[model samples]
Target: MSNLDQARVASRSTETTRAALIKAATSVFAEYGYDGGSVRLITQRAMANQAAVNYHFGGKDGLYREVLIAATRAFEENAFLDPEELDALSPEDALRRYLHQFLLPLVKRDRVSRFLRIFAWESVQPSEVFSAFIANSPPRIFRLAERVVRRFLPHDASAEAVTFAMLWLAQQPMFFVRDAERLAQPPFSLKFDEDALERLVDTLAGLSLRGLSGV
Candidate 1:
């Protein structure tokens, strides 16, 4: 075979190994966390040589960072309205859209639940890599929430007050997502179908506006 053709085949093989490592590592880390998840186990799961992790990702920390960034990217992409779109809408409308998108991922529970599992583990015992990932990532949703929230608050509201109000608004769905399993069972027995979701969004929006009014 020509040198160029051989090089192309080698490139494909390299990427396949890298992708496999990431997929395996995501599952392992999600279940075991960074410290608990060993490189041996990850390499074994990937069916790749132990050296491949270092060759592709520098080491386990780098691999973990890639997995984290991958897991959160989809949700981050879909969960927020563009700032321009948010600006065009009235505060009530913008908030409703934002909250709707926030809850939209709940419908894709299988995929989103995996990501949530990874996040839950990290939250309890964060890794240095996860901290760096968060530090570098843009705070897209929070900024959107802050913009929507400012419309509700007086112009003179302090930064602390604005941040607190944003957290309060954002926490509504965050709490729901975190407790989704528990909320599914029990007396709540809540199902997040289209009609139910709309109602919940409306309820939260109403509560948020009223709650913000007093802030």
Candidate 2:
């Protein structure tokens, strides 16, 4: 093999190793959380040596950051909202699109939702590490939803009204996922199938539209 060819192979191998490490770390973090997890566990899950974690990510903290970056990058790529396009859509369509973008991914990607639940739990009673993590990626969905609502709602709409609308729209998935036990009770059993998801999106959009129209 030529020297250049060998170098190319080496580079590809390194990339593969790094990707594996990130995937393993994301799962570990989702399962055990940031504070409860360790580099050793992540490396073991990846089937790579402990030295690989140190060499590739520098340490556990760095590995966690890479995991978050990878997840967010995938999220942005798959489901990003363009503020410019909001004006083109009718109020109902715009609101539906926004809610779908925010909620659909969480329902579909179970791992990401699990990781987010862990993150949310940590954020409530945060240590320094988790607090920094929350600061690094603050929730932008509420702000984005508020902006979209303002575009559709009357100028006289109060900030509190807009905020309430945003929260109401945002909580649809959380209500199901976070309250799984309650939802499983008699007459309240809710499954996250396609029909259920569509219903959720429609309900949130309808309610927000009514609120905007002062109904």
Maximum-TM-score candidate: 1
TM-score of each: 0.74, 0.65
Candidate 2 accuracy as lDDT: 0.67
Which residue pairs in candidate 2 collide? none
lDDT of 2 at 74: 57
Positional deviation of 74 in candidate 1, in angstroms?
A: 4.9
Deviation from native of the Cα of residue 45 in model 1, angstroms: 6.9
Clashes within 3 Å, all models in order? 0, 0
In angstroms, give how far residue 66 of model 2 lies from its true place: 1.4
C-alpha RMSD of candidate 1: 3.8
The C-alpha lDDT values of all candidates are 0.76, 0.67
- Report the lDDT tens digits of candidate 1 across residue range 48-167: 988999999999999988887776675567553677788899888988887876665455555545565565555457788887887877345556778889988999999999989886
Give lDDT tens digits, candidate 2, residues 74-142: 546645676667668877787888777655543566655654544443433355655575477754455
CA deviation > 4 Å runs, candidate 1: 2-4, 23-51, 68-80, 109-127
